[model samples]
Target: MTSTQRPRAFRIPAADQTGAIEGDVAPPSTVRMVEEPFEIVEAADGTPVPVAPKSRAPWLSLLLVALGGLVSLGIGLSLERMISDLFAAAPWLGRVALVLLGLAAVALAAIVVRELAGIWRERRIELLRARAVEAMATRDHTGAQAVVRDLAALYAGRAALAGGTKRLDTLGDAILDVDDRLAIAEHELLSPLDRQARNAVATAAKQVSAVTALSPRAIVDVAFVVFSAVRLLRRIATIYGGRPGFLGFLRLARSAFAHLTVTGGMAVGESMLQQALGLGIAARVSAKLGEGVLNGLMTARFGLAAMAVCRPLPFIREPAPRITDVAGELLKGSGAEKPAP
Candidate 1:
């Protein structure tokens, strides 16, 4: 079937369905959401959304540009006047002034180049992080691993540049330590989890293939899939020392809430696919498929986020059992993913 025909399992529901889905998003149903002390407003769908901290981007940019322009203009004017005066007064002194000016210009240019390089390097690091997350979301372990290696290499370069300062060395060491552990996590955790995810998704796809339209069974299955994914995420997080305490579970719920947009987008795309396919499939069927797939993917994302937020210590030893080993171990006797043969 076309990707569009897939269920939108990840989409967040309406404000009303928020409660039902919230439980499935994270566990410990007793946990209450702690409100952030900030401006709150209603979303388009009438949901109360919190306003995030404002950025001082425009003011900062304007100030920087204005200061740079003024400095450049003043330097140009002063240099021209000084050179003319020096040339008219003493030719030898004028030559010496020109040489000094040239050296100063070279020094300024070097500083500018260094700053630009730093910005470029920072952006490159961010891009690598995005690529790694995308790879994890798509369950591409090899791609994720490659990205982690690149990240580790970048951290190594930073460490080399850190040189002799104790604080810089410590920061560099911490970064390298995290990246190294991440590299190990890729093999020890992500690899097996990916395999299990494929199995889970395939099994889910089969169960929903026969659905011609949304039905009670379809709805129940959708909830089941979501809840299962959430549980798996919690289990994965716990394995890495990120067991969702009341606060942590609340955090997870908020993150999982993002699935609404993901699933909704899938639904929109699925509708378009239905028209294109001209197979007379019911709109509800396509919508259901999209939701399922989206939710499943979101579940994976939640797990990854949970792991990061929990900030568990790095697993330095490869092939050694971490806080827990394998999905089976994390899941205990819950009959999650069966042991790999």
Candidate 2:
């Protein structure tokens, strides 16, 4: 091995070749990886843009307000005159009317006051709900519980005042129950999921409160009472006439008869004209005439029933369901499919 040890076998460049690395070699300045910072480019103009604010057309509002005021004044003057006339005719009837009017006025005033108070309370409740939601979102269970308690108290008071007829009281009680559940969830069974559920409950309560606050049940009740009182007063007036009240009744009857005569004559003339024009057609269509007549009668009966039920055209209520039943029978003719016995 010591013999002329051949130079270590090495792959050396040939005499004609120049020295160079075998593969590609990257320069130190060459980029291996690149990262960039997030940047928001601004407009070249460098001017800040302005946002337009919303505006209401105050002139329209003012016009509506003025019109409402005029209408109210006219109504008030008319009502006073009507009341004075009624009183001059019959003192007892007048007294009853006055009492009824006073009751109606008091009820109306109470309704307005209650509604305004409800609106205010509802706003506060909404604020509490919002705060509760925010507290829940932020994981402040204690703060959320406090807000919920305030909301429950506010709703409970509203529930008591809204009375039993309106479903508002029921809705309030429901919201309070929801608050109790949320409170339990926050204290006894604390969990992130429970916080979300509580927030949902608060939102639902807010929606329900808003709807109940705006319900028209109170106004409807007031209207029903006022109308009922008016009906009673009219009955009383008919029963007990003040001095010469019989004369008033006579005059009213005469006026009513006059109106009926004119209207009835007109209706009869129109009916006669229609009959005259359709007589030839009726003769031609005699085979189906009975069916057509029956259909028309049924239609009239149905119309009467609808009017009675809806009270749209001022009809006595007693005949409503009877007429409705007749209409139903007409609709269910013998040719129609029979029902199971």
Candidate 3:
């Protein structure tokens, strides 16, 4: 009877239990569930955001700012007239005041002109530099050399126009500088033992030659040729580049002539403005009998002010952008993303 006893029934722990007994085999151990880290994914369907354009301070806006000063001068003159009876008693003093004002105005105008000219020259230099870089990149040595020569010539002409021997010297110095740099580059390229290096050097040399060949004499000739061509084309464009109608022809003529006329008129206007400023100052000073002290003082003050505005003084005006904006625009237009932050 004892031998026939039923097999012992054993209790097993549930799947969640940790400890196991010898009589009871542990139920298959439950795998401890682990949570994998959640990854943040960017949305593939999102539209690319457009970059904001750089805000440039408009040249016209700067011109207008200077106009404000001119307007203030007018206001000051009007005020002086309104208080004329007080000044009338001392006609000499009035005359002196007038002379000082005139000198000041002439000085101011001259300074502004000089500054504007400098800005123009700087812009031209930047343009030339860009052309040179392009020519160099394309292995157009001739073109690069031509650009360098032209730049040097331009600097020389500008210096001459500025009435400074130093600037003239700068022009010669610039030419020498370009020659030295080209020579160095040429040497590097030609001296390389590797065939690849030699080829590259040869290519660079060709580009250098292109730029260098445009000597001062050649640049002058090319400039004359271009100027003549432009004038001729402008005339032709005026006559023919229009719709087929009497009114259209007239419009076309006017439109074509507009730029030339405006430029000519501006030149005349500037000259007249300068003369008027000078006359006004002279008339005012002549009426007063103080030694040239008032005139000299005014001139000195005005000259100083003008230099402050015109010269490339540090921390006064930020340098104009050269390549960054142009490169950015090119990249954007080509549907390329900006370089990573």
Candidate 4:
């Protein structure tokens, strides 16, 4: 054991620990080459699905229906219990309860009907608008006229659109050009409504900017922003003659928020670009004021997106308002301008 312990293992220095052999030469000088990325147009398409779409399971829909039914049943039972207790207590009380319940039920039923009707109308408008856009794109004369007729029917009884609807009716089929028909519909009909819609959007944007700027609490700012955005969407829909019910508002919100999502990147890029271009409006203002201005711009941006979604027709004649346009107005209104510059 002592004799074996006398031999020691050889150790290499940490600096020379590389796996290079004795005859190996140093590697050639490193080249600083950069490869630019390029995209190839992928010609191959994805395989089409042969089966009917079942992305959503049937059980989910069943679950929703069941949940609604359970809620309704619970409410009915509670109401029944209350009414029965009243009856047991006194005949007069029971009679009054029955009348009140009947009235409430009737009112609820009316509201349900109205809401359903509103959703249907909104769906009809959306479909009609899509058809019109496609017709315009394809230069489909017959299809365009059909769209005009449908649009006129949609706006028929409104006193505000009486002239435009009548004009559309009177000019039926006379204008064979798809462009002309769409233009007339957009300008004569949507323009006046467009102005009203813009005014509403500006008002909402102004209010949001003011509230968010003055409010001391972040929660207040957030609450007001959400309230204003929803109210703005609802107001814009109303201007376009859309009676968006709760469900319909959700649909509109989905589209509006989708628009916002797509433009969100551009919004960030725009601010960055403005700074890079030496037009740093944010730099000119105090931090809180800058934050307020940014929030105002975001609100205006959302308002613009809401306009695109809620407006049945595409922005054909009158262009959609730009973020800068709205921001400039907001800045002026709020007295957030650079002082004596």
- The TM-scores of all predictions, comma-separated, are 0.31, 0.30, 0.27, 0.76
Candidate 3, residue 269: Cα displacement in angstroms equals: 57
Model 1 error, position 141 (Å): 2.9
lDDT by residue (tens digit), candidate 1, 37-82: 4777656565888788787669888999999999999989999899
Each prediction's whole-model lDDT (CA): 0.48, 0.40, 0.39, 0.75
> Where in model 2 is the C-alpha error above 4 Å?
1-55, 117-121, 137-142, 151-341
Show the lowest summed lDDT stretch of 10 residues, model 1: 322-331
- The numbered model that scores best in TM-score is 4
lDDT of 2 by residue, 219-338 (tens): 643443334323322232222111113333333334334543544422345443443333333334442332332333323332222222211112111222232232222223322433
Off by over 4 Å in 4: 1-56, 265-280, 331-341
Root-mean-square deviation per candidate: 30.1, 24.5, 28.6, 15.3
**Candidate 4 lDDT over residue span 107-166, tens digit each:** 999989888987887888788889988998898998888887877777777799899987
Better of 1 and 4 by TM-score: 4
For candidate 3, write residues 1-341 as lDDT tens digits: 35877689876668656355456556556544324323332234544444456689799988998999899899988868844754677877777777877898899888776556544554454465466556645766566456645533553433322333243334443434433434432232212212222232233322222332333454653454334323323233222111123333233334334533443422245433543344344334432211122222222222222212212111112222121121222212222322223
TM-score of model number 1: 0.31
Higher-TM-score candidate of 2 and 3? 2
